[model samples]
Target: MNTTTIDKPATTANAPGGPVPVCHVIKGRVVTGTDVEYGPARARFATPALDLDGMVWPRREPGPAFDVPLAEIMDVLVQTGERLTRDPDGLLAEALEFSVLTSPLPRSVLERSYASLGRLFNRRSMEFQVQQELGGADVLDGWREVDGAPSGRRHRTRAFPPRLIHVIAGNAPGVAALSVVRGALTKGVHLLKLPSNDLFTATAILRVLAAVAPGHPVTRSFSAAYWRGGDEKVEGLLFRPQFFDKLVAWGGESTIRGARQYIGPGFELVAFDPKTSISLIGREAFESDAVLADVAERAAADATIMNQQACASSRVQFVEAGVQDVDRYCALLQARLGVERETASACGNPLASDLRDEIDGLRDMQPHYRVWGGYEGRGLVIRSEEPVDFHPDGRVVNVVPVASLDEAVHHANVATQTVGVFPASRKVALRNALAAAGAQRVVALGQAAMFETGISHDGFYPLQRFVRWVNDEG
Candidate 1:
């Protein structure tokens, strides 16, 4: 670890009784100004404005990071991570304190999230990701000989670092950290457009890198700022291929659709499209009272990760059970949803009014549909003969009864990102069918939100897409 003394800089400058000042980081330097802009108002607090033009890096050439060895970059990141964990009142802490105002997640949940942010920067974990995704670190450092080619000619290739504008999602604070780590490991020049929901995390991490290794290539390669998603003045000029090679977007339908128009010949979009996850519970869960309790807890774990705000959190569960068994499972699942966990809180943003109304309507539908729990974020479970019409959220899980596990596959489509299956053994039987049905990942019933390092996200390895492949022909 670097063990450098960290300075506690004010993240925001509040002008007496005015809105907080949100500053922009250009490369490794922080730039603050009097120019004011406010983000869309949320339930809790409003976002402070930033200088958008200051964030634009006019240089067209690659930065020093493009030439540095991958190992050196990893070392800087590891030290930065250590510093993040060790510092009691550092940038990560500052971000957590500010997050309470901008984010809907409770204080305890945010504390838990900030505490684990350092783990994403592990050295061996990063090495594994590089090896798994891009074959090895050698390709990133320089060109390597092609193993097999159809033509009788020698060729070499390198995974060139791209100039990227990451439109990162703010649902999980971890996304910001992961983007920085990925951007650094790939040696890319990253300009992260911070989401309104999470405005501080990425900038704080970048600031830590600046403190740990001042003027380091990795630090100079990163810049983070905030601007509304569809701001044409900024997007119209910056989205061009001359400025950035790709826009890595992570958000819902509106965010993706907004970024699509900017894609063209030189610039492209690597989209982590909005996706929903489901669960398939085998009848074996009901084999015994102890088994049912354990299964319910597992199902709840998947359903309530990040309070069902994460893309991997299970929303709809298909169970191979009769009415009595399924109803019992729903009751148990509802109770478990309110239990606190590392990534979830006992309560979250209350269920949306429309969703609450939908549940209320289902209540009158009687035997055809049964609703458990309510809108206060204690979690809600609805048991129905078929899938519900509205999307489940706010720790809500819809339990759909099916005669066989195979019947659940029909409900999954291209939008499905993960499917957690019970009885672990059944995953093998359903993995192929689930993938064929357009689902990207399958895991044990309780492991939907537990992702391993180097795993593919949204059906592709993101790090592979973050770089450009340049070849040398001989």
Candidate 2:
């Protein structure tokens, strides 16, 4: 492991320092790291030089390693942990202000960010700013009854101002931003271990935070830095009794499994779990054939975002029998996939290698699973000649063949994350069935990922899962 440093004054707004290097609390010691820029995104780290915008960018003159001793490192972690477990109010106020500023992010760019975490981190920053400056709308309040209160006596409430250890996965962008914002709601001191794939987010967010609250101690309540997620030298050293109160993670099977190393008695593990999504078409989709084509165009739009890598993006599809009538459905979907040309978006890191590996293995067995669109950019589509298999691949899309709407509902297994139902009525049957089948979200066939703020990801109303509530039992 290379321990690198650079001399950067804290006044430089371009990265992490200009006069004094902007800081975040980790454990509670003042360990410093500088910003490393990459393409359109930037992150904070102690690395001397970095790959930025297709060139090598070194922030400052290199120097010898700063081994401040393990004991000191322990103090930073312990102190920050103590701050979160003991007093979180002041820090939360600052975090809230920053989170509110993040809501105005463009859906288009948000779509492009995909696995390149810097963009996702940017997304998180966008959400963080919105929450900090404007406070996101109360998600749970949308279902008010005539009296404007809980529908019945089911008015139960819980508040968890818990300290957190965020295990961010490099799989998607903006994930770290989400975890960071969640920690801030508790005003909890944070120990952020950056995933190797998208390391720039913490720096971008911290730099922004320092600018937003230059002198606030809440800035000291969190320590956001970059380190490999599986470096057990660091993990074994820090994932102990007094270091954290909760471990929050987002990713696939390996990531969630790896995060468990830091979990025990007082420190709990909260995971997003492994998930997937798809679309459902209804016969009413052809209320008019032209309308069906428009719906087909929009459905293609939903699938193209982030190249359908998101758990919220559609992958497994079910079409109505009466509309395209199975054969026509496949033909229409393929035509739509070709016409809409969803595979044209920019991408990074090429989706997950594991997903690609899965496709590589399956394509050898299923000839129908051939790549059917332009083979560059986000222009590749995968279609099934048989019920074959659905292994997600790089910017590759799949159009699964189902016998009927009823069979479509039958296929709503545990892998479903979001399902877009056309005609919207079939949703009455398919949505609940898929919900029972383990889906996290359901939407109009074309609006899978664009369901507004409160629609729910997995099972949590984000505000509830990501924030704190003070209830005075007066």
lDDT of each: 0.85, 0.49
In model 1, the worst 10-residue window by lDDT is 1-10
Highest-scoring model, TM-score: 1
Per-residue lDDT of candidate 1, residues 1-474 (tens digit): 121111223344445545445566779987665344464433222233444454445555667699999999999999989988886447788778778877878888889888888899999999999999999999999998896677878899999998899999888999999999999988988899988878778888888889999999888898887766897766877788876889999999999999999999999999999999999999999999999999999999898877788999999999998999999999999999999998899988888898888899999998999999978988999999999988888888889999999999899998999899999999999998899999999999999878876978888998899999999997
Q: Per-residue alpha-carbon lDDT of model 2 for 211-286, expressed as tens digits?
A: 4444444444456554445656556545554545566677788888887877778667767777777777766666
Clashes of 2: 47
lDDT of 2: 0.49
| lDDT for 118 (candidate 2) | 27
Which pairs of residues collide in candidate 1?
none
- Leading candidate by lDDT: 1
Worst 10 residues of 2 by lDDT: 50-59
